[model samples]
Target: MVEAATIGYTSFPGYPEPPYALVYARPDRADTAIGNFLHGLDLADYHVALERMHIGARVSAVFAAERSALVTDFHWVLDD
Candidate 1:
């Protein structure tokens, strides 16, 4: 993964923002896998995502694959 600060963002014809910038995936470092993960989750609820991420001692997430990533200290609430 190459590391560089985001110079700018490019958006497509229609979408909230074309996902051109980084909100979490190390904006200073250009990790391809990290970038892809962030982009893939564009439609996810930011508040819920952050809430899930915050239960830890410190918030952290690691993605080996998009379907599941390692998140620290997160608790799950199940629905019946």
Candidate 2:
């Protein structure tokens, strides 16, 4: 499975929702491993992996959609 995480984000009244960065990984590697691992999938896959193995980690933008205020920054750890 592929783990897609939103490392960070940015938002404002006149600014687009920045995609930020996503740390990508996979279970196994083989011929065309990258294509098979990353392609022919959707974001929901990440959610599933996150629930099952807690493989994915995300730190959203510090912006509150409702109040348009920046929230506190977020951090995480990965050791496996």
Q: What TM-score, over all chains together, does every model reach?
A: 0.21, 0.21
Candidate 2 lDDT tens digits, 1-80: 33553322455453334422333444334332111112111334545534432334322222324562231222122333
Q: What's model 2's TM-score?
A: 0.21
Cα displacement (Å) at residue 13, model 2: 18
User: Which pairs of residues collide in model 2?
Assistant: 62-71
lDDT over C-alpha atoms for residue 2 of model 1: 17
Candidate 2 error regions (>4 Å): 11-16, 19-21, 30-80
- Candidate 1 residue spans exceeding 4 A from truth: 1-43, 55-80
Worst 10 residues of 2 by lDDT: 32-41
RMSD of 2: 14.4
